[model samples]
Target: MAKHLIVGGAGFIGGNLARELVGRGSKPRIFTRASSSLVNLVDILGSLDIVYGDFLDDVALRRAVKGIDTVFHLISTTFPGTQMESSVYDIFSNLLPTIRLVEICLASGVKKIVYASSGGTIYGEPKTIPITEEHPLRPKSAYGQSKLTIENYLNFYARSTELDINVLRISNPFGFGQKLLGTQGIIAVAMGCAYYNRVLKIYGQGETVRDYLYISDVVDALIRASERSGSSIVNISSGFGHSVMEVVEAVEKISGKMIQKEFVPARHGDVKVNILSNKLAKEIYDWTTKVDFQEGLRMTWEYLINKRT
Candidate 1:
């Protein structure tokens, strides 16, 4: 069993990935900020080791990566919606820290670094359906640009050094424990509004198509990336598209509640269609999204209901 370190382990995907790794008895150490909430990892907290630190703190990060065989990089400071925010902040908050992380990983002799990237934002408007890994990266948002920038650095590291790097361009992920009413994850937000009788905000015609991957499937891909030795960049997605309107309807049907909608102008950087192909992941990582769309939504809804009661 290789020693594993999970950076930003308090976020949605990070939390789920931590749960899975702990269950596997790898006893992976979680590296999160001092203020990060541990609610997501509540059930398994006692069985795992947790390290609190800032992403830019050299000493804390160095301590976290020491003696770790595989480091899972899951930190991201900005969302695609924050494209209007300063690109400098995006670069400093995400890109710069990642560059520093690579240097530290190399110096510490870490075996591999699995980076979770955005599949939704990286490939702007798709010329083809089910966008493949080879699809051109034309990001419309600074958020996507920063992620692509990190990928470029990792590619450069791969060419110049012996560091093993696996970049998993993950599609829009949503499931249990996901934050509701946030700017991201329409599925979770819609369900929450339906249950709470709050208005669910819709941008543009609400027909934008996006590939949504359930949380468990995402954890599987990350685990597969860490278990494998060789380095490869792959797209992790459900290979299916879901419109924003489709998510509202799914929530209505499953939760038996109508979501009041408040249509708003679409943001500038929003893309009309962005679905990803997982063929490369299947071929290399031997992984596929096992959760059905409706089933996954149902499970998420049940979790919310159970939480409130």
Candidate 2:
């Protein structure tokens, strides 16, 4: 059995990935910040070895990577309203931690590294629909640019130092355990608001289309990427997109509840439409998204309902 390390494993996607690894009989060590919430990892606490560490601390990061066969780097930070305008948080906060992790991995003799990149922001306004890995990198937000920068650095390190690195540009993943206040998942937040009888605010006519993937599918792709041996960048998405209105409609249909919606001005740095092509992921890791939009919405709604009850 291989020993795997999940940085930021207390987060939404990282928690799911840790559970999946435990199910597969792999010993997964989760490194999370001391101040981070443990709600996502509460159920699996007994099964996982939890390390309280931060990526910015080089000593802690190296300690976490030591003796690990593979690493899943998923640590990132973004201010709620200032994700697009600021480069300081993206550079000093995100990029610095990533660079340190890369250095630690190189020195520690880790076999492979699976990095989580942003599929939503990296493509910017999208020059092509169902964006593939070959699309030109035109990141509009500082968040996207920072992720791309780390990705390019990974490529350079792979070429120069013979390190095995794989990047998974994940789309919007929604499901249980997702932080309702997080900006990434509109579906999760809408479902929560609808369940609690709050207004479902739709930014910009609810026409912004996104490739919504289930969290389970995202975990599946991450695990598969870690198991496979190769240095490649692949898009982890459903390869299909749904508008904000479409998602609300699906939620309404599933929960049999009417939702009050308010259409607000278009958010700054918002992409009108973005979808990622998973053909390359399919060919590379033999992975494809299995959950449809409607079904995924139902599952998420049920989870939230169960949590409330």
RMSD of each: 1.0, 1.5
Residues 211-261 of candidate 1 have per-residue lDDT tens digits of 998999999999999888778999999999989999899899999988899
How many clashing pairs does model 1 include?
0
Tell me the spans in candidate 1 whose CA falls farther than 4 Å from its real position: none
Whole-model lDDT values for every prediction: 0.90, 0.85
* lDDT tens readout by residue for model 2, 116-142: 999988888888888999998888777
Clashing pairs in 1: none
